[model samples]
Target chain A: MTTKDISRPVCILGLGLIGGSLLRDLHAAGHTVFGYNRSRSGARSAVTEGFDVSAELIPTLERAAEEDALIVLAVPMTAVEELLDDINTHAPTCGFTDVVSVKTAVYDAVKARGMQDRYVGSHPMAGTTESGWGASMTGLFKRAVWVITFDHLMDAEKVSAHWTGIWKDVCQMAAAVGSEVVPARVGPHDAAAARVSHLPHLLAETAAIVGDNGGALSLSLAASSFRDVTRVAGTEPGLVRAMCEGNADALLTALDEALAILQETRDHLATTPPSVEQLADNGYRSRLRYEARTGHGRSQESVSPMLTSSRPVLRMHPGQPNWDKQLIHAETLGARIEVF
Target chain B: MTTKDISRPVCILGLGLIGGSLLRDLHAAGHTVFGYNRSRSGARSAVTEGFDVSAELIPTLERAAEEDALIVLAVPMTAVEELLDDINTHAPTCGFTDVVSVKTAVYDAVKARGMQDRYVGSHPMAGTTESGWGASMTGLFKRAVWVITFDHLMDAEKVSAHWTGIWKDVCQMAAAVGSEVVPARVGPHDAAAARVSHLPHLLAETAAIVGDNGGALSLSLAASSFRDVTRVAGTEPGLVRAMCEGNADALLTALDEALAILQETRDHLATTPPSVEQLADNGYRSRLRYEARTGHGRSQESVSPMLTSSRPVLRMHPGQPNWDKQLIHAETLGARIEVF
Candidate 1:
């Protein structure tokens, strides 16, 4: 396809953090962009902020229906189904996509609506604690992963080429805004997010309970650590709630595993009659192992409990030794090393 | 007993992060500060960094034995017992204090040595991920909390006056270094540290496990959230281990409570069929509560979790309505009123 045939005007639904940011970025990149928000005030704000805003979804879709355009549903996951339904009826005859966190359910929804062929599932893992059109910046998607989920029916070459173009545009924006794009499959994305993103929210909520139990004075003593750990809890509570509710199963699994680790550490502390030095050594070694591995850029594959049990190829590198000597040293240090 | 009679130079043991920072701050405030370290390299580095360094502990104590000086033990808690033994034997003439995290044990150690009258337990709640002489910044203690623990034998009025002078110097340093001074009793400080200091280490350790499992790819995908949560883990492994072992009981308690709350949230997400919006609402509200309570200028009595039972008192202006009405309004509209 020629550049003229490939490039078209873009429609962004729900001009909040994601939508507004995407609109700003796309518009700045010289792409004709139109924004639609359910809230009239939000739409007006977008327009006032120099965006081409449409007061209603249908009219906006109708105006941009031709020109082989792309419509991005940049709302929350809960709003995806309804937005898709509306889009199915009033969507321009072109490709459609979304910026929702979770993808499986939305993919199923789109498939059920018979729009699977032209629909792409993408999630840009970029955000801040703030929300709404006012918080949106022009460079929000710079270098952020614009994940495009592919199915069997999708033309691999066409879809890949189309996404590469979109990513080129998006990556520049992401980099400008200090973000990066990472592509991963749906299940892994959900699981990884549950651990990194959703887990922080849960921890913050739990920390907040300390404030709830201890009065304001107790909370006042809360320093940088408390503030940093619970920073995500201070985010949009509705969004946090939605994430927990949306990715319930994966979060539960992660929680169970995390709690098990904590309980084991607690039990060891309670039951083990070790010297203070010995106890400190245990925590130190464990923490050191974690830190060294993290610093070396090891991935989840090497440390996941599921994978560890099945494949025994994971090993730790000691400070100064050959591979064989390092293996022996690791064994001496009581580390679990497996040769795959 | 007068200020003029107290002519002995203050000896600071261990010139690492806290110790070095304290020496710099104290010297700048016109106090004669001498530093001793177990690491010859650390001592040499301290001397190179313009600190008066003593090579041997006993010889150093012997030199200052005739003068009515103060000894501040700024080493890890694991080393406290050994340091106390040395002080009790050779430094009987000098007044002593310590900057260990857990105070009850250190206080008991001093009491057992029959030096309770001359000893005050102190803990300065200020730090960074960096350690050693290189990481020591002169401004590290500018506005940071320098908690001085006193007992029955210590004259409340005299100690209070002395601490006031010390606080002025330390508080100035804390402000200079961008930290806040928090004053609290020993038990409260430990409990709060358990929540704020100790918990972050554990959380970081846990987050680092993801890197261990995932290898380079997953580690690369690790975003700011993971980095922030795990930043503390990157500190001196030995020091972090010492802290966890020293404050094991309180830390374990805090960890258990944190884990329990996380588990409950996980279970709620799994079993409870709450609307996605409600989940987000809860997260938003929880975060708002935490943010409102954080930051300096708040009294220790105001934000103490022990007194507040986790429910922070939402302060309002005279014209504003009651908190309940405001909460109700927020809940209905999915908004949180966070006024910090």
Candidate 2:
């Protein structure tokens, strides 16, 4: 059965950055949220901050199940399997979900516990250089992309309907706090995260390590580009290790692809200057498309050329007399041709 | 002898983004500025914008030399040799400088032309995604690093004094708009640029290319991190190629170093989820150092622990009674220990 009321009880397990942010937002949205943290001081701190929290896990899960609550396991990846095992024994019938960066391994573990019917895996693609509850806030997920995925337990229609009900409530909650929800399956989600999130984190770490090895002179000369690319490298070691280990296979695949590209660029530079037109075009188009999607760019233009197109060359033909005005007129008409 | 007046004429022999921006800043600083562009349209546009600009090169150089002006060759890397030859043949006595990303090649060419006594090679470590005069504006180099180098042909003190007077004017102009000027020799400057600038550009290109090859799904998931890292990849292809080709030797060295780091990280990930503490610590420390240098972080504190030090263990001791207050008090004293 689906939830009849939107203000039902919501339980959060592990009050780290993501969990803390969720609890604050859910509580502010008028839902009763019970926060569970393994640390006694953390639970007490949550209570002092006016959040209903408990240090014990089993009792919290039992109480939350009694209220038919949505239980979100927001712990580190290494702790996910143990928590899943605990949930199977304590509250097997509760609605289950998690906010983990890697989804396949978690989903597989959940399915191994025979709980695929009621579980969804999600990741909120938003964070900062800082971590932990002290750095979290209610608006942490605002305008961010929250990806949701699930195992194929039932028939297509039934599963769609089942998830639609839960996902609708999730979308409503996310929207009320300003975030967008996207749906995907386990494999595609993991693969996409490899290319986008995991690989970029590796790049950050690599950049930081490289600069550190270059000594003080290199550090002094390093500016905006290096800083921007390496910003994520500053995250906590334990946290970064957990994230990387969780998505090891996918991250490796993405890293291989990135290395291949880097090697080709280097070879091209070593021999002769590489033709960077395609790379530049791809980057330009990707940025434009992203900005438009996020509402950060101007209104989209109609009939824009494809990024892969190698047409409509722009050059000066001084020999073609009286074509200057026509060239200006063509540019006004969005022909995108530039003439001298 | 050093110029008697600070308002002596300054001539810029290119109307690209850097040259145009320099002209705007120097003119605003009350210097008698002369602008020249190879393209007639570029010169005309500068004139229309209420600046003294000419399309004719030799005549402009002759006029500026007569006034003992400091001439800046702000053209492309490919054009530097021809421009230096022209300066040697037509205006040998004027003080000279060029704003190129790579310094050694330009310095060599200047020395080859028997102009080592007068020419200084400089690079402003600042730019935007856009190019050309239309994108140029005052304060483009604000809060940026401007590196100046020379061939060291004359005696130390006389050369130093000569450069000091000219460099003072350059620094004053840059500081008037908020940029710091650094002096370095050619080789070290090139090597530093490889690690800090050229390598990052290659990374951006590599990232863009990898994303483009990942099909539409990967493109969809490539968001903020991807965008930040690949921002420099969208630059004009010709310009990027020139920068990369010009710094080929140094870039190869930097790329090899980066590849070693990447391979090490990959091998570690492959075996038993390698301990990433060192990598993470380096990243964290590098980011903090960068932020501190850029004035983006909080004011300095005394006696911060080194990132490499494995000390002050943070753990919960169940046997210790009355330790809670100690832990809290330690935290208040800026200790980074986290206790369960």
Candidate 1 structure quality by residue, lDDT tens digits, B120-211:
67677678767776667777654344554434223343333344333333323333333443434466657767776676667656655543
Candidate 1 - CAPRI tier? incorrect
- lDDT for B139 in candidate 2 is 82
lDDT of 2 at A48: 96
For each candidate, give its TM-score against the true structure.
0.77, 0.80
Q: After superposition, how far is residue B16 of candidate 1 from its true place, in Å?
A: 0.5
TM per candidate, chain B: 0.74, 0.81
lDDT of 1 by residue, A190-285 (tens): 676677666656655666565444444345455566666656655666777776677777767666766766666677666545123333334334
Worst 10 residues of 1 chain B by lDDT: B331-340
Task: Please report how far candidate 1 places residue A76 from its true position, in Å.
Answer: 0.9
